[model samples]
Target: MSDNNEYQGRIVVITGASSGFGRGTALELAKRGASVVLAARSPEALTELAQECETAGGRAMAVPTDVSDRNAVAALTDKAVARFGRIDVWINGAGVAAVGRFDQVPLEDHEQVIRTDLLGVTYGSHHAMSHFRARGKGTLINIASALGKIPTPLYASYVASKFGVVGLGDALRQELGEEKITDIRVCTVMPMAHETEFFEHAGNYTGKKAVPIPPTYDPKTTIDELVRLVVEPEDEVITGWQGGPFSFLHRLMPKAIEKLMAGNTNAVQMGESMPAPKTSGIIHQPSKA
Candidate 1:
């Protein structure tokens, strides 16, 4: 449990708030008395989530946004600030994945994944940092994946995007430190495969069902970690029981860890899952699911 007082009067802007970690974190923050500004591609879903957040005992606003578009993201920031005066924390959690061999997946799919996952974070960070600098203090959290640290075979584009996110966070921290910006904080979260709508919404060309890698943890664990970050922002955090150990092993023995990850991805995401036809998934559009 968290100290509810910690979040009292705080304002948070969360992208991808329609589902998964973003939704869960919003509810948790709402319970803790933080105002939440929800952004997602689905207006209906965002409206419903906003109502739920208010019901959870916090202020709420819904802003339908597609983070990939720079203009849209800019408008989202403007709307959040307009609604809440200023944002105390900003979470860039919007992302998409395309699953298949690098060559097999459509070129457009790969581009879309990069645009949504990596570029989306970039845009959010840019706007958030600008606001934080002017406000004199704020926290920016980027949701990355364990694949950012350790490469897997199937999710090539996703791994690339996450790696970019990790690097981007590091660069931002370095810049902030050089500028003597002590109050503004940048944190990147890396988590192993968890139970979320991610798998179901992933574009698949592998002719097999999209499923999480083995040892998928519960979404609550990731949500708890996100909430913790809000209270005590750190530079980089690896969530889940397996995340730390795997990251450590990868650093110590890159080749061996890569081999193991490849085998695991093959066994679970490819071999173990049922056959399914190719689908564009939510990469091209919002999922009706």
Candidate 2:
């Protein structure tokens, strides 16, 4: 249960609402009395999630959307406004990844990860900012990863996309400050590896079962931070207990941190994991699982 009055009268739009942090956040906000607009590639999943949100005691709208498509993202915004009047918050939580040695993963997989993760955030941020500018207030939350600050092996494209997200958030904040837009906030959330369907959906060519790095925290930890951000927006937030220290270490010793992370990923994702056949996962299409 949540404090129903905390988010009363608020409307939030969440991409990748079918699963992972996006879904968890939506449900939590809904329980707190926020109207949630859900967007994801799978219509069925979105529909189901919408029902769950409503059942949890808040309004919900399911919009089948591919965030990679600018037009689809625009339409998602339009639809949310049509039903809810305006969006108080927009969360760009949609992302995808391909895990393997950079060259071994298909060029198409790498391109798709960029298109969905990086470009999708760009599209969502563009529309959210436009709306915020019109209303003179709103919060844009971009869900980046710890990898954005400390690059690691086995996730080249994901790292690149998350780095872009972090940079994008920083630039947006700078522009807002320069323009004296005090009410509009741009926040980036960087969370360490956590238990989520993200790994299940990632394209894997590592010849080993894809698993989250060790010391993975529960998804709830990251979800709680996201919910808190909606109430108290910050320029940047690093969730998970390990995220802060790891990022700090990287800042102090970039080369050593990088080498250590590469070895850690290899040990956990390759050496410790079971053998598996290569599969494209969900990079090119929606997951059927």
> What's model 1's TM-score?
0.98
RMSD of each: 0.9, 1.2
- C-alpha lDDT score of every prediction, in listed order: 0.92, 0.92
Clashing residue pairs, backbone N/CA/C < 3 A, model 2 = none
Candidate 2 structure quality by residue, lDDT tens digits, 202-252: 899999989998789899998988887786899999988878888888889
lDDT of 1 by residue, 1-289 (tens): 5688999989999999999999999999998999999999999999889999999999999999999999999999999888789999999999999999899999999999999999999999999999999989999999999888998987999999999999999999999999999899999999888999998999999999999987789999989989888879999998888889888988999999999989989888778899999988999888786
Among all candidates shown, the one with the greatest TM-score: 1
Looking at model 1, report the run of 10 residues with the lowest lDDT sum.
280-289
Q: Estimate each model's TM-score.
A: 0.98, 0.98
Native-vs-model 2 lDDT? 0.92
lDDT for residue 167 in candidate 1, whole number 0-100: 100
Task: Give the Å error, residue 275, model 2.
Answer: 0.9
